[model samples]
Target: MAPKFGTSGLRGLVTELTADLITDYTRAFLEACPTGGTVHVGWDLRPSSPAISEMVIAAIRAAGIAAVREGALPTPALALSAMEAGHAAIMVTGSHIPADRNGLKFYVPGGEITKEDEREILMRLGQDWEIALRPGALTEGTQSAENYIARYVSGFGTDALAGMRIGIYEHSSVARDILIATVQQLGAQPVPLARSDTFIPVDTEAVDPATRTRLATWCAEHALDALISTDGDADRPMVTDGTGQIVPGDVLGALTAQALGAQILCTPISSNTMIDAMPEFARIERTKIGSPFVIAAMESALLADPQAKVVGFEPNGGFLLGFTAQGPAGPIAPLATRDCLLPILAPLTAAARAGISLSELVERLPARFTAADRLAEIPTDRSAALIEALASDPAQCAGFFDTLGKAEEMDRTDGLRLRFASGEIVHLRPSGNAPECRCYAEADSPERARALVEIHLGKLRDRLG
Candidate 1:
């Protein structure tokens, strides 16, 4: 079966994510865009990345365009470089999914492609992938990593985090070295922890129990000020406070917005509800979950209020700065893509300035907590059927949430998000990147939010079984 595009990119099983497939899609993407000149390609630390990237680079050259290789780097780094050079880019990554899976993210001359662009590429794609062809030696891309670090270095200044001691859990992330270097450049004492060559899928949004325990252990062992890490491609940030406890991504988004003093903020419906009540942000827009949706909404917001400070973030801690934000160090250039660095720096800086720990800063926010998990081995059709059953009939919706509480209201933004009479939320959606159904819950306390996720996931499991 042909791999399909997800929220941010194309993801599928490694068996089906073949070189021929990559080559075929790369050719189709080039055919779909007239602005193609020099294409920039990068990949993650996955074992399959180099081969997939080679296939894509060869296809770019085969299409009569120059393929400037950016080598192994963070997804956002490649995107930042591509945007600066006005060149299209492709990233070989699987994000936070398991190692058995791999995927690709494409960027046009401007940034991530929109839904229309995805449709165009899909329409252009052929039924069968081409036979493997000899890959041509490509030219090395310019100093994109350096340029990306420079953005933060200039924005936050040297040693801005002078008094902070951060631990970087480098468990085979592509940006392991780059992240450590950036922290050092910013004058923060960084402890490199959990360095591994094997690719590890570290989901920031729904962290695993084993990883959580490890983080806590690391924090206790080293007395860290914070622990920072990212997903496979290093676009989504997973941050831990001094005690090695995590701060939910949506809460981090709020703090980052506060730090940026953003006038217009765009997020997804699945984000924390505090955004709705936040008065500091004059304009708050919630889009369907996905960077593309948020990016488009940001475009509309900027067009309406050109001079207003605009920014977008997701519950995954992937931030997009619609405008260059001025900070103590300097003015940072806008990287209107899912970026991990900005979310990390903006919040850490805010806490440092206030002389508070990261956890303390998080607690100061309105009491709203979120927990997420997925029911694995569930097909997309099955997951959609579940939502359709509830959405098509009010009784189904009411009965589905009846055990927990009355379904006070229902929201179908990107999925089925039902608000309970007990001031709790349960959102269920099919995983875009994997064969699973994701469930999210939010409540007044962390324990309650976690319990809701566990309860609802059990419900889904029983129904599917």
Candidate 2:
């Protein structure tokens, strides 16, 4: 398929993202969202990202907009720079996808492009456009990375992580060095582990078994108090406790929200239902499964009460701050974009203040275990048809979930989500960035939740066959 807009950005295979296509999309973005004199551009560690960045920069210059290249930075860092500078930005990254695939995330001066902005870009695509007679200037900058690191250090305090030995899984993430720097500035001993030269697609939400085992082994071998990492672009975070036990992203979101004293919270429906059980937030809002949806909800909350301390997060541990919050050191300016560092540092500092381990911090939350996995290469049409069949035919739905339990409730917010009589939830949706059908299950026990995901995805694969 051609490069198309997904949940948060434009994504497609590397081979399909030709120079002409990339330039056209950039031009369309420029037309769709006219900016000031400049546009910020950045990229990730993927092999194709540099060439893609070149295309984006060329397109920006052609439109008479100076291009400020913040090379090899995380998506949030780039967005933060552009937003603060009051300019539009584009990031060439595939996020957690494999090396063969890549994507481009667009941002306006306010924050990430909304669905309406996406529609405008789509409407302007492939149209003839005028180029400036004089190409705009091109320059480079490194302040984005430095500013990003300072964000965590100043917000969490210098000694937030003192006396803690943290492990950094430097697995080709664009933010590896920045993570190490931030940890050190917070007075933690960072042990760099598994630094990779090649890009490794590490999905924080659905970590593979091999990576899980590796995390545990590394934690024990290095005598680490906590382990931290991110995906290719470092927007989604992967954090583990002393025992290398992965903390669920939604759980991390709850902890971080409570730590920051947020009054309002917004998250997707795919997240663990246990969030509703948390009493820290005065109000909670659930939306469709994506950052854009959660962000929109957060904006509404802010509109209703501009002084409300609002926060948004995805199930992948990408946290968003909607208002300036008072931190241990001082004030943390709001950055209404998906971020990895805030979620990671907030939980660590909260646990430290409580004199408890990360695992113990998680144990204090409600016992709602969530597990997710995706069936690779399942076409979107096939997944949509399966969901439609099950939704329309009661008998088929019952037969499909025969061994599980009766379907007590169904939520079609973004996909097909069924609440069984036993309170277990099974949600199926086609991945926005790839040709995969994803299954998310939540149960009272971790083992049961994992089994539900495995069994449901197996059935999906068989049905596709």
Candidate 3:
């Protein structure tokens, strides 16, 4: 399929992301957004990303916009730099997808582009445009990476994680080095593990069983207080406690917000329902899945109460700071884009401050468990059809979920989220980044949550077969 805009970015098979297509999208983004004269560009470690970055830079220059090449770095790093400079940015990354696929993420001066911006970009595609008199100047910069590291280290303080042993899972994540540096700077003994030259699509939301086993082994071997990692481009974080049990992303969000003393919070509907039980947040808004939606909700929250400390996060552990909040060292600036560092550092620091292990800190929260998995390579159309069938027919929906419990309520914010009579939740949605059917389940216990996801996804697989 041709590259198209999804919930996060424009994505497609690497082969289909030709030079012409990349240039068209790049130019279209420039035309649609208010990009200043200079635009920052960055890429992930994926082999295809370098070439894609070159194409994007060429397109920017051709459009008479100066391009500052930030080299290989995390998406949030590039975004932070661009936002700081009051300019726009383009990141060449597929973000947790296989290396065979690649994509582009665009940011305006303010933050990630909204749905309206995506529509404008699409409308401008293939349209006629005037060429610049000369190619805009191209330059190199490492300031983005530097700024990202400092954002965490300065805010959290050097001793925030003193005496903690943290394992850095360097599995081809562009943020690998930065993670280690930031953790070490915060006084954690960083144990770097499993650095991979080849790109690994580490999905933080759905940690496969094998990767979980590996994380446990690493934590035990290194006597780690916690293990931290990110997705390919590092916008999403994967963090595990001492026992290598991955913390639910929404739970991590809540802890981070609490650490930051946030009063207002925004999250996607797909996130764990436990967020509602947190009494610390004065207001919580649930939007349709996607950072743009969460960002919009955050903007609304800020507008509603300018003094409120606002934050947003995704189920994948990507946190967004919507207001400047006081940190131990200083005041942290707002970064409206999806970020991985804050979530990783805040929770670790909170655990350290409480003189407790990461797992213990998690146990303080409500007893809610969430599990997610996906059936890959299923056509998006097929997944959508299945959802439509269940949504439109109550009998079919009830029958489909009979093995679990009767469907008492349904949420169609982004997909089909069904609440059973027994208080379990089974949500089915098509993956925004790939041809897959994603299943998310929540229960009072981890075992029940995992079983719900497994049983539902297995049923989907059989039906598709």
Candidate 3 residues 1-465, lDDT tens each?
457687778999999999989988999999899887889999999999999999999999998899999999999999999989999999999999899999999999999999899999999999766779998999998677888999988898999999999999998999999999999899989999999999898889888999999999999999999999999999998899999999978888989999999988899888888778889888888898899899889888878788778999999999999889888888899998999999998988888888899899999998889999998888888999999898999888878888876778889998899887888899999887788899999999999999999999888998776
Model 1 residue runs over 4 Å out of place are 34-36, 127-137
Measured against the true structure, the TM-scores of the candidates, in listed sequence, are 0.96, 0.98, 0.99
Q: Assess candidate 3 and give its lDDT.
A: 0.90
Worst 10 residues of 1 by lDDT: 128-137
How do the residues 75-168 of candidate 2 rate in per-residue lDDT, one tens digit apiece? 9999999998898889999998889999899988988888888899898889766889999999997799999998888888899999999999
Count of clashes, each model: 2, 0, 0
lDDT of 1 by residue, 1-465 (tens): 247786767888889987777877888788786445778999999898888888888788766678888999999999999988888899999898878788889899888888788888888887454433544346897699999889899998896788788999999888888889989988898999989988888888889888899999999999899999999999999898988789888888899988988989899999999877778988888899899899999999889878769999999999999887898789987887899998998889888888888888888888888999888878888999988897888777777777666777888888899887788999999877677898999999989998989888898998876
Measured with C-alpha atoms, the lDDT of residue 178 in candidate 2 is 93
RMSD list, candidates in order: 2.2, 1.0, 1.0
Report the Cα lDDT for candidate 2.
0.90
TM-score of 3: 0.99
Which candidate do you rate higher for lDDT, 1 or 2?
2
